[model samples]
Target chain A: MTRRIRVLIAKVGMDGHDRGAKVIARALRDAGMEVIYSGLFQSPESTARMAVQEDVDLVGVSILSGAHMTLLPPIRQELDRLGGGEILLVAGGTIPPDDAAALKAQGVAEVFTPGHSLEAIVRWIEAQVAAARGQAAW
Target chain B: MQPDREPRPGTAAARPADPGAEVEAARRAYEEALARYREALAQSPEREGLFTTLSGLPVEPLYTPSQPDPDYLAKLGFPGEYPFTRGIHATMYRGRLWTIRQFAGFGTASETNARFKYLLEQGQTGLSVAFDMPTLLGYDSDHPRSLGEVGREGVAIDSLEDMETLFEGIPLDQVSTSMTINGPAAILWAMYLVTAEKQGVSLARLRGTIQNDILKEYMAQKEWIFPPEPSVKLVVDTIEFGSQHVPQWNPISISGYHIREAGSTAVQELAFTLANGFHYVEACLQRGLAIDQFAPRLSFFFNSHLDFFEEIAKFRAARRIWARAMRERYGAQDPRSWRLRFHTQTAGCSLTAQQPEVNLIRTAYQALAAVLGGTQSLHTNALDEVYCLPTEHAATLAVRTQQVLAYEIGVVNSADPLGGSYLVEALTDQLEAEAEKYFRQIEALGGVIAGIESGFFQKEIAEAAYRYQREVEAGRRIVVGVNAFRQEEDRPPEIFRIRPEVEADQIARLRRLRARRDQGAVTGALAQLRQAARGGANLMPYLMEAARCYATVGEIADTLREVYGEYQERAVI
Candidate 1:
């Protein structure tokens, strides 16, 4: 039997622009993955709790209001506190390259920008899930 | 190319007196031209396999008289006439140029106030306010949910004090203001009304528009607070109140700007926007208000995208369809109810961060299209908008782009300058037909609210957006600086950055206001608002009392939420 990779997507804080997040959710579904979408205006604590409840293999956060610098750290801390640190975390939306690099260093698995292809995102997620399974076996 | 030859015996021209023969002769000539085009195509092929507009509508190589052979009087009526396909006004820009209103607001209210004054000094005719994420989502500056987002995307207004400061010196009766707010539109509008009262301006003397359209929030912008039923009730309440009290104000501006920004096609923007408008009309009718009483003040806002002809055609069709629907379907008698006045903003999604300066040229062309399409007002986006809020210089340049179009470009000299072109006429009809099909589908789904609940709107917008992204990635469509004409540069354009201190200052001010204001009065007013909401009474009067008491936005919104409950969108995609 094959295992289906489940992922959770959410928009945190007050950013209302969700077109990018919706597109990513649809693309992930089309790629034959199980996806759960947490609708808009979620707090970081609620988002982490939902991710843990869903027991997903990956978590994706989309922020476009330039609040990533102040919003992501608390979300990352909450995820760690909830013992979901192993759940691969990704971020996307109008993030500058400098901020992208900073977020990656602060425990984000990857960061996607405006024009990044969906195939690239799918490939990255698949690779991360496979690597996590191998580590679990070891 | 070939010269005209002598008519054959069977050709229509052979019998000049017969009109049917002449039609047959024209058809024969068209077929011969097609054959010649195919032969030439075999030798030197066209650049692309299928040519299409940005919205993916197919276009023919050439349009002729036979295509879209519409009667000029019926289809393309004179300006200011019924079925206003040409324009809503006869003189258009010649009588008075479109108002140059720029959308500007950021950082603290004081800072935003300074920016507004600067724009007015720069010859901007009107003001359009952009509220921050917290304010739009109904959060006070000091709320925990608003921690890092205070005054980031736009100005933060927590109480009537902030609203007063935001428009301290500006005369509410003279300068018309347009606020780009939803979700908490009623609360903020109450603040504006109280501020005007403090200035001794009568409600009947005020002139402005509040972007109180909530259906689009559920459809595209995703800034909704309460569920559809209550949110829509609140919008209708404002419309009802404005009609009786503030005659010069537009209570709701049915907006398609965010729909196109969310990546819907030109036809979808037109269809969805008009659908929302019709839904609003039905809601008002259900309230027992006569259609003509409130319909005249109902306005629209649309996105002028990069597709030149498609955008113009969308506008023309929108006016015609709206006029006819108001007259025939709604039984409206007043000519003012038939007129569809709108404001146009250049598409923000089309602006590119790469080669930022090129966006200026793009905006200029879009402004020209809007003028030709006969928009009542216009806001041209700055070059650096895709990165952050526009800088002072960029906002000025955006305003100048409109000035150049109105004065120097000569496009304003004639109304509906492209009214007679066969291609433009065909595209207009094609868009109207496509929109009718969507309207039918929406009707079958039990109207716009049900369509939203069923995820129909979300699915359509998502599919359209994804398809556009795929096209850009596959090199099928070229977005000059993004996909094609790539250039390597060391540094990007200098973008406007909000200081971290802005949030701290705003939060502190909110806390101080809470400490100093009459807390008992605020609580009482909010309780009254809650009681009003619990019943079927209109909540505007109660909200006005709360705003006058200096109640925070969060307090008012929370009071309503207690009764109506907050909305949690079902995952659509």
Candidate 2:
């Protein structure tokens, strides 16, 4: 019996457009993953804590209020502080290319924009989880 | 001539003696033609198995009289008549062009004031204020939650002092203003009224619109502070108060613009917006206010998206549906109450950051659709809006885009120019039916508030958004710059950037105001506000008093928050 991948999707800060986050969560669930969705207006602290408690394999944050620069770092830091550093962090929304690169440099594994596909996101998450499991075995 | 015996005008001179025989021959010919088409399709099949509009409405290859043809007079009356499908006014743009109201706000109050004056000088007909996230969420600039966000997206109005500065030197009576704020809309509106009073403009003389529609906040924008029940009650209070005192002011603009911006399809935007409007009407009726007295002041805001025909159909359907519901369902007597006046904004969601200049063309077409659909006002999204707040040059270009359409283009000479088109009429009927289906489903869930509590609206919108994204990803739908017609080397446009000092200055000003104001009067007014909130009394007058005493937005919102606890939204997924 193999383990099912667990993912946590969250919306950080005052950005209330959660259509992307919700859609991603549903697609992950349909792909046979266990998904926990943190509803709108969640703080970084709460999101990080929720990820640790849920013991998810990945944490996805969506921000469209142009607060990605101010909001993403705190979530990354909280995840590290809570000992969930291994949980792959992915960000997506109306993020500029420059800021996406900066966010990636600051420990975000991936940054998806408006036209990014759900299938691509699911594939990336699966590959990362499998690679992590292989490393643990080694 | 006898009707049955006279030959049809366009029929052949020599034809079959029997009508049935002629029909049989025509059917045979059509079958042969369909077989030939199939053979052709086998060599080059259609692009996709099915075709649909932006709202996911299935499209047929062709439409004819046999397909869902509605009665002309009943479904679409003349302009300014009942069930105003053509338009609300007899002379829509011919009499006077739609108001060119560009929504502009950024940085501190003084900075935003400069932008407002600049826009007005450039021929912007009216003012539309976009408050910062802090103000939208009912927080003061000095609050911990407001750090780094104080004047980022829009103007920061923490207190009446800031509001006063925001409108300084602009006479309130001369220009109408539309504020885009919810959650703490009553508080901000009070500040505006107070500012106008200080400007020596009587409440009766001031004309503007306050986007106090709280239902859409919970449904889409998600800036809700209080729970649904109390939040709706607050909106009703403003409507009742404005109807009695400020007759010229629109207390609420039932907004579908944000709903569409949140990735809902056109039909969802229409159904959800109209459902919310009906809910407001019902709530006001329960409050014992006459329908006609307050209904005339209600307005709507919609998004004109990339799908030209679909967007036009949505607007026409919206007017007809609202007019019918106002008269038949709610029994409104006044013609003004039956009119569904609305402002249209080109879809911000449709703008792409890549090849940002292409967005100019997108906006011009969307604005054309709005004009053709007979909008009362319009705001074209700036080309660089997808990147950041628009630069001064970009915003000016956005206004010029509207000017070209209003003056250079010949579209303004006619009202509802697309009304008689076969496709437009069919789509209008189709959208009206789809909206009616949603209205039934919402009614089944008890009402809009109950449906929201059950997470119905969120789930539907999410599903639609996901489907659209999947289509774009799979190359089923082509977005010019992003998925198709890719460009290799490009130079990113210079976008506007809000200065960091704007937040600091705003905070310092708020702190100073807190120190120097009559603290005793502030305390007294706040206590009264709290009392009014806790009781069954209308809280608008108390809010006005608090504003007069210079109570900060956060203070008044927090006072009400104490009475009605903050809302916590459940995850729909």
Candidate 3:
């Protein structure tokens, strides 16, 4: 049997608040994905470094500490430099819609907000993984 | 004292004589009450805008004999008596003030130790250590999972060596310590024990608390190293171990603080936290330990949130409810078992980053509520906590806030000053009823673990949080800096910035430890741990061994993951 999609869930910067990140991690795990949850107060460099080393298919960054204005873009830059730009990057937290759009433009595949259902997040991940695999096949 | 004469609202006498007249009578009574309230409100327009609380229990224009007569002794007995709603102790802060513990830790162990010493010298009565991300998640400083996260957020203790340096000068016997760690709490606790032993203090002599409440970790906190079943087993092991070894130590502080911070309302926090405590009690019962043996040492931690009366009522109700349940349902014989001793931390989530200094005021209010609610210990959040780590100056002021309340403020002179007040009593009764309703719902759902799996608790918290946020946005609730009084001003002067090199130093120390520790001994112990994990044996003893052998938190967690696999979050949303 093929292996399940492996994901690493992380919280970057000074956000000790981990409710949203944890819920998403649990949801992803329930969707039959292998998950490694690196707990709170992580820096972008550290998160990116862990993602690369863990060899996860996706890195889910949940930041609510408002440091995302400085943290996320550098993590995206680091992932690209590490040659895992192909790896899926998902962001979630208290991001405003406009900022979320900007983050997606900067290469975050998707952003899950507070009201987003777990089913929606799981389905989105499955679709993203499927789409990536399809592109690779082509 | 006198016989009942007239009927009050919601009572049978207040209703109409005939069944058919009920709705009309109710409507007329409501209209009359509204008219009377409007007439009163015309004089003071400012009173019209104020809400009673998040619970939607309306405040009366004036409470008189017409108001409901509440039971004083039944609802709130004398302090230190059965149904301890007044206060845990009769004297309270008048005799001894609440322990002013500043949760301080960041950077290297030496740095945290220095901070601890500094805070102690500044008249802080107790120490509360905050571990970094890696240590909390059971990762070593040098783990691939650690990276630039080592000591930047909080102190990183990889082994006994780090633990030793963390408490080098502090006498564990003289002052109590509280570690806000959950995932690897048992290991960290063992490290503390080993440190105390090295310092010539017996394990029995040490007094401290470990946030070993793994149920909360799964339900709200989400910092578990193992999955729920095993995680709870580990917690029970700590409870069992502490009961036998360290009588003075609080092995698990079943925390409602995190649940409240996770956005649960006061009642939800109370109900859910109490339910979690019951679940832990049941787990210990199954472990073949007597209730009174470990129950006295079991403590609780609550968040004193922005809702003043709601928070106070929640605390009062929690104590009464726990005492009743422990005595009646659980048949716990000991008076200590009946007492619900808790530590209160002012809600960190209520602090806003918009106007940082405003957090000090918010924290002070919450701290006052905690004091009125009668917490055994308290930690006031620093002003800059909403934005960054608390600088020495900010933390000192936070500690001083507690001291001022303890000394200058005469709040502690009398126990439960608001105990007999009609408003507070009514609110407490309402809160107790609401919590009871929740208890029934959770019971129907098969208790806390089942409620967690079904996402019942999470849904309630989310809905309440959403409603509260809406209230804030719509001006129903006012946070001075967040929704009102909006302007950028001079920021709080004392904000501490963690030096990035702290992570480098941690990693370097981790490397040296790995190189120096006997590789053969480490491997042998790890092999034994792997065998034990697969054998359905208790993981705590093996974890204790690992901690004794100076195994990094990550190595043990990794090995457990290899054996038991990791948890999968089922999408109840």
Models 1 onward score TM values of 0.88, 0.88, 0.77
- Residue-level error in angstroms, candidate 2, position B385: 1.7
> For residues B106-152, what per-residue lDDT tens digits would candidate 2 score against the true structure?
99999999999999999999999999999999999888778767888
Query: What is candidate 2's TM-score for chain B alone?
Result: 0.88
lDDT of 2 at B30: 46
Reference contacts preserved by each model: 0.61, 0.55, 0.03
Error of 2 at B313 (Å): 1.3
Model 3, stretches more than 4 Å misplaced?
A: A1-61, A64-71, A78-138, B1-70, B490-494, B533-541, B571-573
In terms of lDDT, the poorest run of 10 residues in model 3 chain B is B61-70
Q: Provide the DockQ value for model 2.
A: 0.51
Model 1: per-residue Cα lDDT over B192-294, one tens digit each: 9999999999999999999999999889999988999999999999999999999999999999999998889999999999999999999999999999999
Docking class of 2: medium
Stretches > 4 Å off in candidate 1: A1-5, A127-138, B1-70
**Ranked by TM-score, top first:** 2, 1, 3
Off by over 4 Å in 2: B1-70
